[model samples]
Target: MVSFIGMIKRNMLVYLKDRQAVIFSMITPIIVFVLYILFLRGTFVDALEKYLESAKGLIDEKDIDVFANMLLLSGVIGSSVITVSYSSLVTIVADRQAKIDYDISATPVTRVKIIVCYLIAAFINSFLISAILLTGGLIIVSLLGNTYLSFINVLALYGITLLGSLSATTILMILVLFFKTTNSAGAFQGLLCAAVGFIIGAYIPISQFITPIQTICNLFPGSHITALYRNVLLNGVIENMNSSMNGLDNGSLATTLKEVFSLNLNMFDNYIMVNGMLWYVIVIIIVALIAIAILFNKLYKRK
Candidate 1:
């Protein structure tokens, strides 16, 4: 057990020591926030205002801002877990590039232990960074105005974040195993950061996309994870706004936004609820882990 922890510790150090990996891991998340403040925020607010056409006079503008920002917050947080996990896994690719993985595989520690250590370290590193992003998000939204994030809501997000991190770690591990050089991994992570916000409905609502594109994004677990975050982050605010409007045409807004944002997803021609999304992500993680185990045997030295 101690050796296991030590292996994990070594992985963590490799990730932490590479300042480029650490900074780039966070860079995409920061860009998401910055883009939201400068561009997307106004766009979202305007789009939401269009949705509020019937109840404009009845609803406070600040209420709209709260909802928009929370939506942004959820997306930003979601992107972080994915980007950070992929970033943490960069260490594995770096090891491969350096031929250090060959040395480790030759050790008596066993391949399963080595794989598990890398996964655990990535999960921990991603979750920690994701948690910090959540903290900053909550604080920023709170300072701006009323955020619906109660203590329980925050705790639930942490649990979801944990799952998101693990899913990302497992999935990225499979990708990492294919990388013979850090350059390949680096290039992929760059694209991941560039695309993740859009794919996860962080930048634009998936509903606005063409049917096939929307379907493709829904097939991804990260999009479903964002759905979970939306439910936790914005549900309360939706409920309150509904009450404030008092049937002022917003009674369906909850249901509408759920559809619009892919908060309640459709899978295989069947509608999926929040709980279904949870299970779906878990299933994806399991599948990814199984694949990783198989790949390690074939791709890495099985010694």
Candidate 2:
């Protein structure tokens, strides 16, 4: 047990000491937030205005800014989870290419312990980075939208972020295990950073896509993670806005907005509730972690 802990500590130190890895891990989320503020924010706000105008006084224009910020903040958090997990993968791949794993294998460490160390370190790094991004996101939302997040909401955010990070880390660990060279892993990581936002519906609302495209996005675990985050982060603002519009049907507005923004995922003509999605992600994380451990054990025995 002590050796397991020591391995985790060593992996974390190696990862954290690399300046390039830390900075690159953050670049994707930073760019997404900047682009959303500069361009996409206005576009979403304008669409809300147009939609509300058609509603004929059913909704207020003042609420649009708050809603847009909430949506973008949710996307930013989602992007952070993917980027940070992949960044941790870079370290693992580096170690493998440098034959650090070979040296570790020569030691007394069990293969399962070594694999668990990597998984634990990846989860820790991903969760910590996601938490930092979430904090910055809440601050931006509060300052720009002039709204405060409730205590319950903050707790919910932390829970979802932790789960999302774990799920991402496990999935990336499995993917990285297949790569024999850092260059291949690095290339795949680059592609992932570029496409993950769109694949997870962070770049655009899932509802705007074709049915097939929406289906594809729904199949990805990150999309479900994004949905869970958006539901918690935006539900209050949406419900509050819905309440102010007295003539609107109770909960209708909130439901519609959630659907339009992909804050709720549709599966087989039914939307998966947030709790169900959380459980699904948890199951995936557990299964992936176990599978990777078994695979690594076999590889170690062969060696």
How well does candidate 2 score on lDDT at residue 43? 79
Residue pairs in clash, model 2: none
Q: How many clashes in each candidate?
A: 0, 0
Model 1 scores a C-alpha lDDT of: 0.86
Best by TM-score: 1
Measured on C-alpha atoms, candidate 2 has an lDDT of 0.80
lDDT of each: 0.86, 0.80
Instruction: Score every model by TM-score.
Output: 0.96, 0.93
What is the lDDT for 6 in model 2?
88
Q: Compose the digit string of candidate 1's lDDT tens values, residues 1-303.
A: 888999999998888888877899887778888989799999988888887787767777888889898988888888999998998888888887888887898888888998899999999999998998898888988998888778999899999899999988898889889988877888888888989988888888877887778778888889888889989988988787778778766378767767776678765556678888889899999999999999998887843
